[model samples]
Structure formats: structure tokens, C-alpha cells
Target: MKSSIKDVVGEMVTPFLEENHMELVDVEYVKEGSNWFLRVYVDKEGGIDIEDCGRVSEFLSAQLDERDPIPSAYFLEVSSPGAERPLKKPRDYERAVGKHVLVTVYEPVDGLKEFEGTLTSYDETGLAVAIGQKTYRIPADKVASARLAIVF
Candidate 1:
């Protein structure tokens, strides 16, 4: 159900995003307590502001009203992913190169699943992160999750 929602939202939102020079960062549908929330995360070269979110929300609200793809009631939220956003796709990982990042592996690598440091490199094969004086080369397949990290 959530997958279908994400897919539908992704398709319906793309044109609107492109027209506004925004990028779709993520789509999430989750149940919190008694309510269901549908979140759309968007970004651009410059950071997104409240106005951008409001505009996207207004556009998406109209589209959802027109299509009525969702059968159940849900809250729609459109916002920026923020500075410490996730590195979900290959392009995301690629862009994070030379930036600080946090990575979690599926299984322990060097007896640790979590690591944070500078992303020296990321390619089709693997990722190299410099943790202090040591550099660890992590195969991309072993990564459970990766995100830009706040150095502080």
C-alpha cells in the first residue's frame, strides 16, 4: 500500500517539481499512532524555504484532489529534506563525495556497522571514508543506509 502511494506520489509530483526547478528527495507514508502521514521531501541547488514547501503543498493538494488516488484519509506534508539528508541513490552518494557522511553497514565491517567521516570517494564499486587517520573502504552492497552528516 505504501509502495503504491509512494509510486503514485512520485509520478504525480515530478512534473510539478521540474516546473518549479525542485528535486524530489523522498516520499514517505507512515502510520503514527492513529493517523497516517504522507510526506514529500523536496530540494534544489539552494536550500528550500517555507514558501517552496507551501507552493508544492498547494500544487500537490490540487493534484491529489483531482486524482483522489488515496482511498484512505492521510495528512500530506511537503518540505525540505534538510542539510543532513539521506544518500538514497547512486547520484546522492556520488554527490556526497568530499562531504562528511554517516554510513551504516548491514553487517559489521571492522567490528562496526556505523561510521562517520569524510566521504573521500564513492563509485559503482565501493565507498571510501576517512575516519580520523584511518580510511575504510566499504563495498556499496554492504551499506544499510548512508546520509550526509553534521560535523558538529
Candidate 2:
């Protein structure tokens, strides 16, 4: 059910993102408390501003109205993914190389499930994270999720 919604939303919103020379970071449909939220994350080379979010929200709203794809009432939101933006696809990971990142593994690596450090390298096989003095090579499949972490 959730996958279907994501696919539908991705399909509906992708053209808009591309037309605007923006990238679709992610789309999520989830229930929190008594309400459901359909959150859209978009970005570009220089990063996105509030105005970009507003435009995407307006355009997506119109598309949703015309398609009427979702039967349930869900609040629509469009925004930047923020400091800890998730790496949803291969390109995202590639772009995130040389940046600080936080990654959680599907299983423990070196007795640790979480890793936070600079992303030194990434390829089809795995990612190399420089944690402190040591570098750890984590298989791409072992990662549960990864995101660019804001360094203070």
C-alpha cells in the first residue's frame, strides 16, 4: 500500500521537479497520530529555498487535485531535506562523497551498527567512511540508510 503511494507520487511529481531543473530527493507518505502526511523533498545544485518549496507545493497540489490518486486525506508538504538529508539513490551517495555522513547498517559492522564520519569514497560495491583515524569499508547492501550529516 505504502509502496504504491510512493510510486504514484514519484511518478506524478517527477516531471515537475525535472521541469524546474530540480531533483526529487524523496517522497514519503506516512501516518502520524491521527493524520497522514505526504512529504516531498526536493533539491538542486545550489540548494532549495522557501520559494522553491512553495512552487513545488502549489504545482503538486494541482496535480493531485486533477489526478485524485490518493483516496485518503493527507497533508501535503514540500521542503528541503535539511542538514541530514537522506541518500535515497545511487546518485545521492555519489554526490555525497567527500561529505560528512551518518549511516546505519542492516547488521553490525565492527560491532557497531551506526557510523558517522566523512565519506571518503563510494562505488557500486561499497562506501569508505573515515571515522577518526581508521577507515571502514561498508558494503552498500549492508546500509539500512545513509544521510549527509551536519558538522558542527
Best model per TM-score = 2
Candidate 2 lDDT over residue span 18-136, tens digit each: 99999899989999999999999999989999999999999999999999888999999999999789998989999999999999999998888999999999998989999999999
Residue-level lDDT for 27 in candidate 2: 89
RMSD of each: 1.1, 0.9
Task: List the candidates' TM-scores in order.
Answer: 0.95, 0.96
Write down the lDDT of every candidate, Cα atoms only: 0.93, 0.93
Residues 1-152, candidate 1: write the lDDT tens digits: 78998999999999999998999999999999999999999998878999999999999999999999998899999998988999988889988899999999999888889999999998988899999999999998899989999977
Model 2, residue 139: displacement in angstroms?
0.9
